[model samples]
Target chain A: MSSISLEVKDLAINLSGNQVIKDMNFKIKKNTLTTFLGPSGSGKTTVLRAIAGLNQKIAGKILLDDTEIQNLAANQRNIGMIFQSYALFPNLSVFENVAYGLRVRKEPKATIKEKVDAILKTVNLQDKEQSYPENLSGGQKQRVAIARAMVLEPKILLLDEPLSALDAKIRIELRNQIREYQQRLGITMLFVTHDQAEAMAISDEIIVMDNGKVQQQGSPLEIYTHPQNIFIAKFIGNHNILDAAQLRSLGVELAENDKSNFIIRPELFQISITGDSSDYMAVSGKVKNISILGDRFEYRFITENGLELKVEFLNQQQAFMIETAITFYVKKDNIERVGI
Target chain B: MEKHIDRIIAKIVITLISIYLAAPIVATIMYSFAKSWVNTILPDGWTFEWYLQLITNSDFLSALARSIILGFVTTIIAMCCFLPVVFYANVYDESIKAKLRFITVLPFTIPGIVLVTGLVRVYANLPVPQMLVLLLAISLLSLPVTYQALDNAFIAHDFRAMFEQALILGDSPIKAFVKVVIPNIRVGMFIAMLLTFTNAFGEYVLTNIILGGNYETLKIYMYRLMQSNGQASSVLTTVYFFFLAIISIIMIAIMKWQGSKKAEEVEDTKKL
Candidate 1:
């Protein structure tokens, strides 16, 4: 299997006289899945389309295995794309839809049949071989879409929020199925989605973007734990953002003087009934609210200075009263400084 | 009980409307078959003599052939010219729909005699034959029918996405259009052809006012019979209705066969 590396350097795009993507850059190593996670109009879908060569008038380089493809047509680029609608040919049967790419390439009949059958089985949709798109459920249509694109075995696959149209239950079910296929085939894949939890769940590397620019790109854990900026910190996880002046006044050292924003993860702060001396700084606050999630509990606290902080607790053995005061401690190392 | 009452009322209304619409055609058909029914409750004698006159008339036969030729020619030209135009407008400029609607309804507002008169002057200097000019005029008259059919097809199917999907699948744009887009919209195209052809076939005013006796069509031949044989004109109309019914049945059969296939596919998917 030949794994192709993808690189987009200083890429920019303007649609109808408006700058939609501005100086975006990213690279994907071979045989890995990277997701562009952002809100709508954040230029994530446009970047994916640019890489797929669907959008013209894009500036800068898009390289697949050292070959510049920005000027190439979509067909010449050899990139597979699954649209959000699944865009299955409604007239064709599942077998025929999967066989479309090979048939168009003028592969022999026997080869097309063999490849299509194998892919249908991989998607676990072999029983729907003779079924048209209208005859299949939403989940089945999704599988057929993946099978159609992957059967071509293009250099890279780009998916534009393929699961956004599905319901919650099928979305999660098909999500794992896609990850399994991508890993098993070792194909280079770039998936775009606006759902943060979905990005965290399936992405090997998540590229968080906002305002038509890349905010940060790292492993899911790294993005959760070490968000590089204030936008990313707030976007990725529920973190208490406080002024560096408050931390410094509380006897914590400053990383830089000009940047005043610091972040602490909600789960990193430990809350207790007693305000005891510890290695970390301790602060007391009154419990404002407590919310019970499926497997965890979140507590909202308001300090003496009227600063609110959220702390999460997995073990809910100690029930703190709503108006009672509790002390929450955080290590100095858990404090992450971020730029505005 | 309320639902049952509503169903009965709807059935009664539909039956009443059907009879109201069918009454004129029934009277005309009975008149053509009557031998002599001047003031009686029904025809005193029924004869096939008028029908025989219609079949034996050479002018009428030639006129029927001419009308069929024009129908096929006009419908074919309309479809060949407008499919791509409709597809382009749909994909590139959606605002073209308003323009299309305007042009489609324009022919209806202008009297056919007026429209044909304007046409003769415009082509007065052209070297084209009057017959060719007539065909072109009729095609233009039915342009909206063909264009609307294709426009509706494009609206129903997202041809842009299908085209893009085909290109990504390694087919050229032309190939994708020919193989995928055309087949998907084939039903709409067939409907367009049939509608335009039917309009061109029954057209009387354009053919009568411009081409006149020089190029007599089926409708023109029927008009000529009104002077000499009023009963023959009724016979001609009855025979024309028969053929129309046959053609309608065949077209409906084709549409239903294809339509049911699609419907079954949808229901099957639902069952899954």
Candidate 2:
């Protein structure tokens, strides 16, 4: 197994007498991109800030390469951070902004120029070295911010929703660029975002948090395929979840009620003619609505017990009419059993 | 049609009010330049004699120099003393900020005469120079204005961006303040300097009471000249007014430049 690049153990953060992060623990391996994924106000950003040493009142131990650094100031931590706002120096030219770290370390002017030039080229900002931050586009500003952080070559790079402020197209473009840059540099990175798709797109591993606690932590496929609890199942992707009692009444034997949850991804449900199929769990429902989503048709249905379920088909040609009574089959293996 | 009529009436009213506000300064300048005109709506003749006389007066020259020096000194001292504390309060502890804000404004809200009177009584026993006492008084009075200007600047800044970038770049707080915060809020700093300079230049009561006629600022020169009541006094007033007008023009030019720069930035961002 790869050695841990960064580790947080029983970390807690309180702000103005309110607990924001509670006993959060995670370990990120070297040369990997780890993401903290959660909704707004879920303390994901707070946890990232704690790791960066931006949150002073944080409790518990944070180890960077096996060295305890929880008490270090943000500058002393040597952790590069890209804020949601990009945080580029408005007055400085792109070159100066990127060269700021080297200058602060008292590097010789020649070396500063060489490193800054190289890093600017790395972020595709070499042509715009003379541009002030205020004159740059959102995407360009984000790149500058990235370059500014990367030039320091710190232990870990912390990105606090860096692409959240960009337009959808720009966000996608920047996200891919960031992932490519991270891969090229082979640096450990902790990316924080509320968007699951963005997190899943780049993360080697993702920690889904909710209400100040870690709900689940795993690789993208692991999280999508097998969430550890209901929150994770709901948070990672769209899911049609039902209580064990409800699943049991549908001829699905749930192993336990108090500790397990029945979760089926929206796309996992199969629409077909009713038949005796040992390898699949079947349910009968009336289609309530149909949405054409280009490549797929999303069907919303109401089960006999009033549970709402969403099922998707490959095309509108496969969609059943509204109010049509049908049985949806979920392959048994695809029906994930999550323990809370 | 009715709305248009109302708009015309409103414009006229605004124009008249603007004229009323500006008339006194215009009249002052006219009287100062008039060769011998008196009790007339317009000057009988225009001459540069008053302006010339002001150039030759040694006492007037000394007072003008003192005013400029005091203005520069007071603004420098006020900014150095207040900005760090204000920036700290703004960033770290907001609760303490409220109390500090109150303290900074205490000198402004209290009646100037009363405050100067108290200062005189208290400082009479101290073995400080009269000029030092005068500088202290002017700085104290100007602190509230300077602090407010800087505080507003801090509010207008993207502080999260400032700190985050600084951290990522491994910059200490002081370096960040010098490089990032100061440049971003240059307009605000300029306005603060102008305000402090104007306050110290025009301040009369504090200087009068503090120096007790030993030291003279531009305002004191004008006051002394006003006692004689003639072209000399008018010339002194004109000199003071001209200096203030020059400062005001410079401030406006700086403000306009900043605005245009901001607009250019916006346009550039849009293009991207």
* CAPRI docking class of candidate 2: medium
Give stretches of model 1 more than 4 Å off: A1-4, A245-257, A272-279, A315-321, B1-20, B92-103, B108-114, B126-137, B155-157, B243-270
Residue A10 local lDDT, model 1:
95
Please give, for residues A23-64, the per-residue lDDT of candidate 2 as tens digits: 888899999999999999999888887888777798899999
lDDT of 2 by residue, B1-272 (tens): 99999999999999999999888777777788888876777788999988888889898899989888989998888788877777777777667877977888888689989988888888889997877777888888888888888788777556756765786577777787887777877888888989998999898998888885777888888888888856778778767777788989998898788789769877877787
Residue range B17-102, candidate 1, lDDT tens digits: 99999987887799899998788988888889888878888888899899999899998888877888888888767887788778
Interface RMSD of each: 1.6, 1.5
Cα RMSD (Å) per model?
3.7, 3.2
